[model samples]
Target: MRADAKKNYGRILEVARTVIAEHGSDASMRDIARRADVGLATLLRHFPTREAMFEALLCTNLDALTQKAVALESSNPPDVALRSWIREWVEFARSYRGVVTMMAAAHTNPASALYASCAAVHSTSARLLSNAQAEGTARPDMNGDDLFALMTALGWAVDQPSFAPRADHLVHLITSTVLLGRVG
Candidate 1:
């Protein structure tokens, strides 16, 4: 990328993060471009689509979550690490106002720009889950994908105003169920 193009791209992503956090995953690209002090054409040249822009914005958070999962594996017990990572995943899923919905939608759509990032998340989640299962800390019946779905469900629930107050309790309850009474 050219110097000016790279600068625009970085600026767009930086502004998009703030704009999307304020407005949600559905925030307009034009608004983001305006905030970034770029033209719509410039933004489009970089992101192409709204989902692509959202994906780019989310990539940093997703990468952090993946890295957290990796670090927890060696730093904590399997059960503790898995549960901790799930909590982190839930927080990541709910970071933006409507990000859980966007993640849910992108999670299954292989063609979506965010699919690769979501898949990487799932891969890391699976590693944690499989490790727990192997260590007899988690249920053998549920796979990583199942855990991912359950975590996302909890994320969506906690994102609601009604559930926001009890989010931690909800996370613990779901974690207990996922752990199948093996939590320690």
Candidate 2:
């Protein structure tokens, strides 16, 4: 990419992050272009679709979360590592507003722009859950899909105004009762 083109791309991504933070995953591409001081054509040239833009924006953070899960798997106890990673995943999902819905959809759609990243996160989460279950710390009946669904549901709940205040408590309750098979 040329220097000016690369600069515009970076600027658009930066502005899109801000706009999406304020408005959510459904934030308008035109608004992002306006905020970035770039023409709509320029933004579209860089990101051909909304999913492409979101995939670019979220890739780094999702990769970081996967890496964190990997590290925790090696360094912490099975239950502790799984619980910690779940907390972090919920926080990441909440930060992006409506991202949990996209993630849930992307998890099953191979053609989605977010498919690879979401798959990586899901696989890592499954591994963490498997480790915990093997150690008798987590419920044996729960699989990776179950865990992923729970995380997304919790993420969605916490994003709501009515549930935001109880976020921490909900996390604790889910981790203890649903994942750990203990009373929360």
Candidate 3:
């Protein structure tokens, strides 16, 4: 991509993040084109589909999140590591509220690339769950899939309008119930 193309791509990601947050994954490429001040042809030239655009934005951020998960999980106690992972997740969710909904979609129906990328993200969560369970911090009856569902549930709670500035509370609640042995 040329410099102007890169700039347009960046603008498209920003506008797509907001538009998807407000209008959802089904939000039209035409609207995204409008918001980015690019022609529909340009938007299509850059991102051939809505999911393609979403994956572009998501892969950009989620890659950083995956790195953070690795660092945090390695350097903390098992339970603390788990909490930190959830904290990172909530941050991602708030930075792009569409994240909450997108993760749900990824669970069952994401495009191949999106699904594969999400599987990579889930690998981090699975490691945290395994570590916590081994340390007897998280519930043993649950596995990574269960933890993923719980985190997404917590994310949905945080994404609600009522959560507002206190979205972290949802992650805190989930940690207490699913990861931590006691509320602290």
Return the top candidate by lDDT.
Answer: 2
In candidate 2, residue 165 scores what lDDT? 88
lDDT of 1 by residue, 84-171 (tens): 9988977875677778777778888999998999889878888898998888888899997898799788888877779978988888
User: Residue 119: error of model 3 in Å?
Assistant: 0.8
Q: After superposition, how far is residue 170 of candidate 1 from its true place, in Å?
A: 1.1
Write out the backbone clash pairs for model 3: none
lDDT of 3 by residue, 36-140 (tens): 999999999988876678789889788899999889977988888888888888777776665666667775565554786677767789899899989998888
Superposed model 3: Cα runs more than 4 Å off: 18-28, 108-110, 180-184
Best by TM-score: 2
* Stretches > 4 Å off in candidate 1: 182-184
The residue-level lDDT of candidate 2 at 24 comes to: 91
lDDT of 2 by residue, 1-184 (tens): 9999999999999998899889999999999999999999999999999999999999999999999998999999899899899889888977898888999899999999999999998899899999998989999998999998998899999988799889999999889865655433
lDDT: which is higher, 1 or 2? 2
Ordered list by TM-score, greatest first: 2, 1, 3
